[model samples]
Target: MDTTLLHQYQLVLSSREALLNYCETIRPEHLAQPIPSYNNDSMGSLMRHVANTYLGWLLNFLQQEQHPYFTEDNHKNLPAIRSMFEQVNLVVNNFLQQYKDDLTAPLNLPREGETKLTLTPLELFTHVITHEYHHKGQLANMSRQLGYIPVDTDVIRD
Candidate 1:
């Protein structure tokens, strides 16, 4: 992997830590409360979904055993969600190490419907990180709707 990409990912992790730390200040119940407009998803569910996307794409490329997405009932709390992301981090590290020599080599996957899916390691990494940040925004909005003011979770902040 390029050192630049690794550095960028570290920045993303910094922002994620900021966001999770802020999430800890939210009411425990709010994390589990379903917000109907966002597909009735609770904040916890969105977090799990983000982790799942990382696992789904990267693990598939690694040809590693994959697990189903975490259930809201089982991982709706802060500690459990944090732990899930820990595992996600491990998987991400393994993926980067495995493809460090050639990040842009195409990885062809089993077809979905009529179209086969193909992506480079870099593309997969980019997708999962961006997906996390996208839903991180949603989590912030959910916190606002639940009556808590969100803090700055941007990649670079003063």
Candidate 2:
């Protein structure tokens, strides 16, 4: 892999691990608490969404397939948060192994009713990471509103 792709993947993996650890620390009851009305998503839902989003990106990367929007089924049920986390971790591991040989190839991302968008593998990797970070921020906010401390392991800080 090129230096940029390698760095982006490393950052993604590290951030994912950190986010999972943070989620693990949250009290079980708090997991079900609803986020504010503005978002209307429960903490559990947001967590599941983050995992599903990454999984969707991974599926695109490994299978070169187009997937639908994020959903609970895709996340293996956020109500069972631990299992969901395990599923996400498994997907990440599988993705790393499957794409080990093509880390430098450009990605083919298809959009609905639009031309396909192409990005370097490194760019796609970073896009997914940033996507995760975006949702993770919302999760952190929900956690804090629910009176829990959020994890501080951001890629920028790391």
Candidate 3:
């Protein structure tokens, strides 16, 4: 793998691990607590949504594989949430290995009745990572408002 691509992937993986660790710290009882600004979605639901969105992007967009993993309704089930994380991790790792020498190749992501988007694998990786980071921050703020201590690791430290 190119040094730049490897570094980017490392950053993404580290951030993802940190976010998951923070989620793990959440008490099971607090999962159903409603978050501010989000109507009808609890902290747990949001977390699961993030995971499922990544998986969907990977499967439906990147890999062009029509998998029946995520749907609009079932993204919040505990089993689905767990599976989403595991699947995202596995897919990302595998994608990195498979395209280690082709980081510059454009990723032709399939869209629904639309033209595919042109993105490098690295770009897709970064998108997923950054998307997760955005949501994680929201979750952290919700946690704080709920009187919980969230993980406060800086990206530089990871």
Candidate 4:
């Protein structure tokens, strides 16, 4: 992988760390509270969904493995969620190493009852990180709903 891409991913992780640290300050009940309007998605569930997207695309779809997705019951607390992201980091690192030679090589990913989805390694990486940021915004909004003022969790912050 290019050093630039690696550095960009590091910045992404740093922003994610900020979000997780903010989550640590929140009450467990607030993290677990279901927001009925948004399909009953709790903050924790959204975070897990982000992690699972990394696993689903990079690992399961890329490697053709059937890894089990994390459940709310199993990952009920911040530590468990952090650990899940640790696994995400590992998978991402492996992917970077594995595709260092051909980051732009196209991959035909399976789709249900449709044509296969084609993506390059770089595109896959971009997809996962962008997906995380999209949900990260939702998490901040969810925090506000639960009566907390969120800090800056972006890559460039004051």
Mind giving the per-residue lDDT tens digits that candidate 2 earns over 12-38?
A: 767767776787777766776666653
Alpha-carbon runs more than 4 Å astray in model 3? 3-7, 70-83
Full ranking by lDDT: 4, 1, 3, 2
Instruction: Give each model a TM-score.
Output: 0.92, 0.69, 0.78, 0.95
Q: In model 1, which range of ten residues has the least summed lDDT?
A: 60-69
Backbone atom clashes (below 3 Å) for every candidate: 1, 0, 0, 0
lDDT of 3 by residue, 25-141 (tens): 777656667765677667777867776767677666678777666554444444455666777777777777877888779877667799878898777777777788888788788
lDDT of 4 by residue, 1-158 (tens): 36656778899999999999999999988888898866888999989899999999998988898988878764588998899999899998888888888889989998879999999999999999999999999999999988999999999998
* lDDT score for candidate 4 against the true structure: 0.89
TM-score of candidate 1 relative to the true fold: 0.92
- lDDT (0 to 1) per candidate: 0.84, 0.67, 0.71, 0.89
lDDT, residue 100, model 4: 80
Q: Find the candidate with the highest lDDT and give its number.
A: 4
Superposed model 1: Cα runs more than 4 Å off? 61-64
Task: List clashing residue pairs in candidate 3.
Answer: none
lDDT per residue, candidate 1, 1-158, as tens digits?
36666677788889999998998898888999999889989998889899888878877434556566667654679999899989888888777778888989988766547566788888888998999999999999999999999999999787
In angstroms, the error of model 1 at 130 is: 0.8
**Candidate 3, poorest ten consecutive residues by summed lDDT:** 70-79
Using TM-score as the measure, name the better of candidate 1 and candidate 3.
1
